[model samples]
Target: MEILSNLALGFSIALSPYTLMLAVLGCFIGTIVGALPGLGPSNGVAILIPITFTMGLDATAALVLLTAVYYGAMYGGRISSILLNIPGDEPALMTTLDGYPMAKNGRPGQALVISGFASFWGALFATVMLALVAPALSRVAYQFGPAEYFALYLLAFSTLGGIASNNQAKAAFASCVGLGISVIGLDNFSGLPRMTGGNLHLMDGVDFLVAIVGLFAVSEVFFFIEKHGKGGAVGVKLNKFRVPWGEIWSTRWTQLRCGVVGFIAGVLPGAGASLGSFLTYMMEKNIAGPEGKFGTGVPKGVAAPEAGNNSAAGGALVPMLTLGVPGSGTTAVLLAVLMTLNITPGPTLFTDRPEVVWGLIASLLIANFVLLAMNVPLVRIFVKVLSVPPALLLPGVTMVSFVGIYSLTGGYFDLLLMILFGIMGYVFRKMDIPTVPVILGILLGSNMEDALRRAMVLSDGEWTYLFSSPIAIGLWIFAVAGFIAPVYFRNKIRKPQAVTD
Candidate 1:
């Protein structure tokens, strides 16, 4: 009954003309950002944060708008993945595996429609789960100590390396690189620079936004030039937009299963949508038996990852809202926005600022519907984005990235940093070393370090304190098991197939 009342209050605020309009506008902008390669939800929200301040809206409305953009961007990323074989963002990478193949087979319209529906189901299911489960989960999270938090972070790193890539060594190396970057600034405990190279800007550590833009947007430009030459571009044909209702219906079980898996993954810190999508795709491949032509553009291929990523997006918000801990890069930005507004997230956020919490929840539900409605009829228009020449598109993307990063820091140094990372990203791509783990490492490194430091302080440097709590021990056990489970299961599954062959 209380939940109903809270939801009613949320709807009342979310349905207001101003808030509703912002939601629609956010969805529109997010789709465009997501469709464009390199500029993702993090960039979209980070770039727009200043504009939100200038609009003079209250905290609730500003958050509603930004959160909508986040959700919209997730929906938009599939556009390029399916149409052009370019992932709009890291999370959409898996989509390219089957999405491009499906489009190439001349089911472009069906592919788009199927992904749209899958994204819708994923977002809707996760949002509903957020509404129902967050309160209870928040209560559990409230009991966490520094040790528990550190253990949880370890779990994230352990599971992430295996799940993010087939090459655990590369992932671990990338994660270590990210951790090294995270420690570049002044140490909080000792008040000394760790790896600043004595530069002034290095004293503040690397800006997350700067790194993200360089690694994704700027690196993409380099790859685009290399792959397509100066003037070449991939051309896509658009058939009449049609919903494959029958095909989508047949994959309902896959969608549901993947959605659940994605939501659970999202709820774990640092797991993010990319991991969720990858895990679900692998799961579906295993379950679909011999007939699942996953790599050849199967409908379920598109559906599973799309659902998982969107659901993971929704799940990422849970920890951010309830525990004041962001599960992904984008949510980290959202957390900063919340802090800037003087609205601290965590358990008290529910009681103290019911309006903001519930209103944001309500807006998410509305935004999902908005994205679905907009995507279906307007997909043909989105597909047209693929027709733009690389020479033109690449330059435009570079300009947008520069403007967005400059707007945040107002420094040329950051611009140079962007280019440097861009080159590094390009090199990493060429070497087949995954860059997502690098980003994840940077994102989670500081938090893990802080948690570990705090735990040691509490225990007078006793290492056993890290596993003092049942929760902490359980998390450590899971971390070790998760790291080994994938390799074990892969071998088990493949061995039987080899025998049959």
Candidate 2:
């Protein structure tokens, strides 16, 4: 009842003309970015973040727009995966397994409709879960101690490394690198500079959004170069896109089951939507036995993983919102955004700022419906978006990045710094190193340092106190496992196609 009342209040706020406009706009832009290969939700959010700041909109409104974009991108990513056999992100990789096949069979529009519907279902379920459970979950985070936090961070990195990337060493190294970079600016506790190298820009530390743009967006330019002259795929005519309503409703059970699977998969550390989808597919295959064609354009296979991944996308939000931890690369970006807004999203968020919480929840509900409508009737427009020349599109995107960053601080140094980071991003891609860890490092670094310092303060400098709590111990174990597990799975898990250029 309280949840309902709170949600009603949230709807009141979310539906206000201003917030509503932002939500619609966010969904529209988010879908475009999501549909583009190499520019996943994180990059999309990062690029637009500066623009929102420049607008000087209310914090909540900005968040509403950005988050809408996040979900929208999630909604749009399936387009490329289905039509081109190239996933917009790793999570969408599983979608391609069946989605591309479906497109190849002349059902690109159908495959898109199925995936869009699944995204809606998953997102709807997640919104409900968040509304009902976030406050309670936040209370759990409040009880955490430094030891527990350290463990939590450890678990986050290790689990992420173990699961997100194929090479555990590379992942762990990435984790280490991220943590180290987080320590770069001034030492909060000691009030001394450690790694700034006397550059004033170094004192402010790295801007996470800048880092994200470089890694995901700029790196994508390199990837685009790899396949420069390749034309779009055939067999994906977009004339008909009405949902096969009877077919979808008939598979309600599959939708429900996949939603649950995706949610659970998202909650677990190191697991993401890709894993959720893959697992769901295997489950469906087993359940149907030999009778089901399973992978050969079967509705269930597409429905299950699509629902699972989208649900996982929503589920990943739980830890980020309730626990201040991100379960995937994209949510890690969201975490950074929350910090920029000065609204830490965790247990305290529910009690201290219900408006942001409830408003976000309400907006998500609306966005899902919007996605269903857009994806079905307006998909042709989105496909047309793909045909826009990259040369023209890239310049506009670049200008947006520059203008957005300038609006944030109005500092020439910041713009220059962004350029430098962009170059660094380009270099990182050439090395085949994942750029997400660096951004993660920048986002988590300061907070982790503060947590460590506070823990020491409470413990009176007793180092052993870091492991005093069971939760803390558990987190450490998880982190270490995250670091090691990737190595264990490297040989077993097949590597996806390497990013090009």
Candidate 3:
């Protein structure tokens, strides 16, 4: 009953004209961003976050708009997957397996519409699960001590390397780089700077907003120029543009099951949408046995991954809202937004600002519905986004980053720092180093330091205190397992992927 009333309050705030407008606008823009191949959700969010700061939106407004974009981008990824055989993001990679084939089979409309509905069902399922699970999780988090908190953060960092990584060593190096960047500013425990190099801008540490934009957005621009600046994609024209009610109804159970699987994957510390989608696609294929023809443009093939990834996207919000840990790279960018707003996310977030938490949940519900409506009837519009050439798109995105960052901080040095990070990001990408860990390391470094300090203070500088608590010990076990287990599981993830799909 309390949850019900809280939801009512959320609806009241989300129903406001201003917040609703932001949701609609965000969905529209997010779909376009996701339709662009290679930009992905993390880059999409990072690119637009500076715009929110430029707009000077309050916490509620910023969250609603950005989260709306998040969902919209997830939905829109299918556009490229079906039409261009390109995934808008890592999470959408599985969608290409069956999505492109269905398009080639001359049922692009059915594939697009089916994937849209699958996305809707998956996201809706995860949102409901999130509402039931997050509050309980947040309450449990209140009992964590410094040792437990440190262990949890360690678990987050340890698992990041396994996400779509070819080399764990490269990921570790990126994490070290991120932690190194995090320590550049003045140390709070002592009133002295650590690695500021006598620059006033370095006094506050590297601004995460600058880091995110440079790493995710600007770096992509650099990679595009190096790889495919002159290239363009040819989209499969949509024929028989109508809803596939029969197909959608037949795949209802698949959508429901994939949602469950994806939500679980999203809730894990480092297992993200890519994992969710991969697991669900494999699960569905196995259950259907050899007769299912998974790689051959089946409606079930399209539905399974679309639902799983979108569900994972919603589920990824769970840890971020309750534990101040990001379940995915995109959520890490969202975490940066909350940090910049001076709103700390964790157990107290629910009690300290119930309005923001519930408002975001409510607005997300509306955004899911808004996405379904836009995606179905407006499929034609999003398909057109594929025609946007790299030449114009890359420059436009780069300009947004520069203008938005400057408008928010008004610092020339920050711009230089952003370019430097961009260069670093390009190098990292070329070397096959995962960038997500680098972002997470920087994001969680300060918190991890504070937690470790508190633990040391409480235990009189005894290092054993870190493993004294059962919760802390459990986290340490998981962190170790997460880091090493991925190497064993790498073949399992790769073997199931169908080459043609």
lDDT of each candidate versus the true structure: 0.81, 0.76, 0.87
TM-score of 1: 0.84
Residue-level lDDT tens digits of model 1 in 1-501: 889999999999999999999999888888877887656887567667655765577999999999889888888899998887877776787888888899898898898899899999999999999999888877887788889988876776666665544556776787788888989998988999989999999898997667766876688789877877443237467776567899999889999999999999888765678777877888998898669988999999999999999999999899888877667767767876786588878788888899999999999999999999878777766666655666787787788778767766788999999999889888886776666556656766777799999999999999999989999899999888777676766654331010000
TM value for model 2: 0.93
Top candidate on TM-score is: 3
For 413-462, candidate 2 gives per-residue lDDT tens digits of: 87776776777777765665656666667778777778888889999999
- Candidate 2 lDDT at 64 equals 87
State the lDDT of candidate 3 residue by residue for 1-501, as single tens digits: 879988998999999999999999999988888888867788889988988987889999999999999999989988998998888777788888899999998999999999999999999999889888999999999989999999999888787775546677887887788888888888868879989889888899998989998988898899888886644456688886667899999998999999999999889876778778888999999988889999999999999998998898899999999999999888999999999999999999999999999999999999999999999988888888888788888899899999988988897988998998899888887777878888888898888888999999999999999999788899999998888888997876673221101
- The local lDDT score (0 to 100) that residue 199 gets in candidate 1 is 97
TM-score of 3: 0.97
Local lDDT at 171 for model 2: 61
TM-score of each: 0.84, 0.93, 0.97
Q: Give every collision pair in model 1.
A: none
For lDDT, candidate 2 versus 3, the one ahead is: 3
lDDT of 1: 0.81
